[model samples]
Target: MMVLPFLVAGWIFLVGVYGMVTSRNAIHAIGCLAVAQSSTYVLLLTVGYRRAATAPYFTDTPLRTRVVDPVVQALALTDVVVGATVTASLLALALQVRKRHGTVDPDALTGLRG
Candidate 1:
């Protein structure tokens, strides 16, 4: 069970990288980048998981307090937010390119030559 998430994340990361390398459109490339980032987020979140860990919260139970690792959870949450913001920014840029140039294909986006 613990390994399932890792496997899925790794597969997604590989697929993302492959897509980035093979994609011809700028929008597709950005989507691939997002996929890669999402995979890493999943991996980090899985790292915080334990076989039988309790939720990280204020509780009187010493075992519960000891079970959860706050650091990993915090880092994962921060990364998730940052990744989302970056993905949105990249997608916006792609949209702007399409609007201004009328094409999202990198090869077709040749700028005016002097």
Candidate 2:
């Protein structure tokens, strides 16, 4: 119910976006993109968080007890997996670009104009 976590997530997202927008190198941009993706973890956790709530496992907890949303937690986990995959693919593409163009600078990759 706290607003601080949500604000923190938004701040993290904006920072990542700013870094991406200002990044000159492809690798830096990829890192920034990962940072941006990380904000979703914060946001998802915030959304699912409950004060004094138990884990989703109900093995020992009473049925009336509050528990965090399992669906949101699953979504967060899936987001992490997808983010890592996307980051890896982008890095591989960047490596290929550097190998072929001898540079990772977005502004210098004029060969991509075709």
Candidate 3:
């Protein structure tokens, strides 16, 4: 079960990277980048997983009881927010590039010497 998450995360990340590398459109590349960034969430969740571990809350459990790492969970949540923000900003930039250059293709945009 533990290995499954890692494998899935690796696959997702690799696929996203491949898409980004092969994509011809700027918007598609940004979407691929967002997909790659999402893999971090799965990885972080897997890291926080604990066999037979209870929640981080102290209620109904002793202070020393085994519990999943709250820090990892917090980091994962923060990463989600950061990823969304980055994706939105990148997409907005791509939109502006399309409007200014009249094309979203990276190859076509290369001629923008000015």
Best by TM-score: 2
lDDT of 1 by residue, 1-114 (tens): 668999999999999999999999887898898888889778887887776777777656674354667788888889889988998898898898889999888878888333
Question: 1-114, model 3: which lDDT tens digit per residue?
Answer: 669999999999999999999999999999999999999999999999999999898777887789999999999999999999999999999999988999999888876767
For each of the candidates, the C-alpha root-mean-square deviation to the true structure, in angstroms, is 2.6, 0.8, 1.7
CA shift of 101, model 3, Å: 0.7
Best by lDDT: 2
Q: TM-score winner between 1 and 3, please give it.
A: 3
Order the candidates by lDDT, highest first — what do you get?
Answer: 2, 3, 1
Candidate 3 stretches with Cα past 4 Å from truth are: none
Model 2, 23-106: lDDT tens digits are 999999999999999999999999999898889997888779999999999999999999999999999999999999999999
Model 1 stretches with alpha carbons more than 4 Å out: 1-4, 63-65, 112-114
- Where does candidate 1 have its weakest 10-residue lDDT segment? 58-67
Q: Relative to the unseen true structure, what is the C-alpha lDDT of residue 102 in candidate 3, on a scale of 0 to 100?
A: 95
TM-score of every model versus the real structure: 0.82, 0.97, 0.91
Which sequence of candidate numbers ranks them by TM-score, best first? 2, 3, 1
